[model samples]
Target: MSHDSPLQDLDLAAGFLEPPPRRDTYAGWQRWRAGRGHFAPAPRLTLGQWRALSPRERSLYDLHRTATHVNLPLQETPMSLKVSRLVNRRIRNNALKTRPSTRAGVMVTGWGYQGKTETVCEVAAAFEDAWLAMHHHLHPQPTPGTRDVHAPVAYAQTPVTAKPKSTCQAILGFFGAETKRLTLPELIRQLAASLDDHGTKALILDDITRLRMHRADDQDTLDLIRAFMSMNVTLILVGVDILGSGLLRQGHFDEHTRQWVLPPSQHARVHGLEATQTERRFDLVELDRFRYTTPGQITAFHDHLAGLEANLRLLKAPPGMLTGGRMPEYLMRRTDGVVGLLERLIEDGCQEAMDSGKETLDEDLLDDVVLSLDDPERDALAGEVPAIPGSSRTRTTAAPRPACARGRGRNTVFDDHGPRGQAHG
Candidate 1:
């Protein structure tokens, strides 16, 4: 009780001492933190290395086609690499800054099953691993950067309903809280505390388009999201190509910008904006189909096919015969350069090969599968739109990707809901 005691001059470390959220216990903290143990570093055979791997050895016994099909998305894509690099740079910059500017947010949008989730998961894992690496650094002596490192990367799916309370609850769910029964005030308080407890730097919100809104909850969710950003939480929203209202100032949906509109025509640009407008729209990373439009593109396309064929179970032609054939060209044409569609076609073809006891995806089997897999919705979207005079807004559906990767389109009944028409069935 001395005058000017040491306690008088000490600022308590709230992040270090804060108790767990009301609904979350120390057990939950350990459970969630246990996830850190499972991650492995970047693979030795990176996707590029996979593409580069090609040998002339001829044998169906060595290939693992089924495994390849299952693990296609698990293997890193260029898009995934780009996303990881972006997340790492964002976290590293923010962590090291003395007076950081607004955290950079990113919106990764694509059609469903077009690898959005996988890409986001990769980014989240990569972010989490950085801290893991920092924590497990070898030297026994106290180190500068590694000592204070704490892993705070959280991945949570946005709720189906775009309410602020729901969104808050979702963020809390990732940290292992029981969110459903908690009151909104309790949710927010616990959420902030958890963020502090983990020293969270980034939160990857998957299926973020679900956060889109049209009701009063719109403002609520928007405010909540804004509050997270204000807390120095870098938010990455992953979802469908179109992000709905609440994020936009105007609240209108625009096809070209691929962002919600803001008020009085003041808008946010997801990509290509100046540094000053960083807060308005996220850094846009759009994933779309892989087209074989250029010579280099075609070679890369062939390389991709070659990699897949390398793993195919049955060998009908010479090893890597698919690469030499005009099949890749035909594939690009049929698939319209949609990677998901292409993969689906390959997957179905592989299944047919296995089912028919032929172990080989011959041209006829691929042909039958392609005919059966053609989509109706894509046809409808592709058909002509009557041009309106004086409206310069030409809606350009991605040459189907961009997450501009727009399809692995569903098998709807053919036109007129007719008996599966073979013509682009």
Candidate 2:
């Protein structure tokens, strides 16, 4: 008789937790908030202990470890902490306004893969958690709403081909409102009603840079966003390179406060909708990448590395595997201090280590793993490297990459030598 398939014999789903849900809708946002930061790290095992496990048990443990690695908690950095404090303060201040006035909103602009979306989402989720607990899990100001969805924090993405009506529908979609055959006026009314009924204190519109002002539809969509301020919700717009995206048309930076300020428009209303809250004011913030310059900067980067090293589940991982002498510098060079890229590199490196039986991360092993910057053409396009601050040295010997390891280039314009004050528009 044929034995059962090994894959079928092992229960892959036995110990896995429900995966984290997207935060784009009411249901998803609630599920995400409840499950945020709930993942436990994979158990570390000694080589002897690993060897003691049965074949099926080892396979299950390996799969569980992979899941834990993929779902590693986002490390708290200086930039992320500052963003959270500022965003939470704004939300708290907006919620306490007894007077009828439009709350000042915030716009977060940064380069791609700098954790802008994750940082803002974390802040919003934390705020919602506190707000709900304060109200004893009841809507503080409940309207006669049909659905029982008490969404205090609404998160929606800007549509790819966004128009005024479609933008309204996007927010309404978060509340599970039916948008089919709905007119623009009906859509706005529904959105406004939902926002009021659900007691939403903050509305996060991600990928706000998707709107191009050159198009009439996009310009109208911007006006609609301005009008949304009067609905008594603090708007948090997160995007990449939003300052240069023409979203803040005619905004000037104040040298004293260092904020890009947008004055009220003097134009007539669009769609005959009176956008009384015409002052398009937003405090532009950026979640910057890591820098390797000063003593404080070096300490911060080392602390970050130490945190990651502690979370790793490799059986043979040494105490300072990630934070040791050359590993940190090598990682900095490979990722250019970007958090997302660094995480991806470490994740891939860990997978390689486990598969190759090395069970540890190092320079030689990481050298074989190519990143988006590995392509020679992409490296050339990345322009001249800026010398590291407080040092005047250059890389001499380069580790040879694998033969078939040509990287896929995306953000090749940012040089990897040092931190840049501004992203290329």
Candidate 3:
């Protein structure tokens, strides 16, 4: 019988198609090879050779070698989940003791850029998690008249173009009730029935500022708030200082409502842990700008950055490319203690290095990167080099030269260069 084809041979002697490049020289070759498979000695290429690649070729090479795309899970463990739970717990506790005629209310106010939105997000997460826990049988049966009305509600449960009803009817629908056209009193009765069924007692309204800002005098909105309060429901109203200002100045709510201002003392207490401590006792909350790097955290972050720069210098980076242990200092100076600016600086520097094919960044690169990072208004002001337009140049050509410089052709006389130029004008 004929032997099996060599391509399909079984237990046949192996033969090499080509020898691999030596390991020591592979790295240099790999850099030059750009995108064609692993580097091979037969197809040696220089840095110039790689540089000469067409844009498309280079892109393909990058894709084949260094480029990778990942569809990161869009869903992250929501950062606000914990804070939401705490707020929800307070709400539920108040709701349990509240009656249809009496309720406890709290107003939360802070300046803009403070973590008001984040706080609201956290509260929402807590509510969601609480519902999930109960559904999964991890929590005991919810107490009657204290259950969350919104937990069981689905977005698709309502029909399109349905007329708005009483707040109690809305709440009932939230609890998966199909009854429609509920009167105000009937709605309240249903709400009580549902809460009793689910054992939920608390309610939270994030950003009462919306109502205050848009429709402070809208009877329906006012009635809704009043109704909840009358039911003795523990209500937490989150808002910016504007909301508090609005309430105090404009009188949105009646005098019976209590206002608990979050002073600096509360802020300090919440964020006042040692730098190295884990599991912060108080939620470290602030306006968005002040969140990532607190004033207290800045020094430590700078210290770490300095150490990193020093280590890089110790590794003997090229002159001009070397940070000279000044990168951190430069960043600190440029940022002026703004954490957001510092983050953008780092991002811009890294991106510039990648674009320029430079293994190390220089001071000039940092300056350019920082300048590029400036906001439009800042950039406009920062540009000292005047732009000479073509039309301006044409106009200058049409205009007669200064009398003193007429014989000197187009040479500028008042150059401000020295005494000779200065004296001529």
Best by TM-score: 2
Candidate 2 Cα misplacement greater than 4 A, ranges: 1-17, 145-148, 254-259, 263-268, 271-277, 372-425
Per-candidate total of colliding backbone pairs: 18, 0, 23
lDDT tens digits by residue: candidate 1, 249-315: 4344458755443322111122111234333335666665455556766666777787766545442
Q: TM-scores of all models? A: 0.60, 0.82, 0.37
Q: For each candidate, what is the lDDT?
A: 0.51, 0.74, 0.37
TM accuracy, model 1: 0.60
lDDT of 2 at 66: 78
lDDT leaderboard ranking: 2, 1, 3
Q: Which ranges in model 3 have alpha carbons more than 4 Å from their true place?
A: 1-89, 92-103, 111-114, 123-198, 213-220, 230-233, 243-245, 248-425
Instruction: Write candidate 3's Cα lDDT for 1-425 as tens digits.
Output: 12332112211211112343221122322222222232211122244644565665444433322221111111112223343554555555554453333444455444432344435534433454555566683224555455343332111111111222433444454455756755644555565556555444444444334333233343334334434443334555544443332333323333342332221112112223112211111112223222224555444545444433332211113543323456544554544323334444544554565467663555556666623333431112111111211122243455666667446465433111111101000
lDDT of each residue in 283-314, candidate 2, tens digit only: 88888778888888888889999988888888
Candidate 2 TM-score, C-alpha based: 0.82
Model 1, position 341, has a per-residue lDDT of 58
Cα displacement (Å) at residue 198, model 2 = 1.0
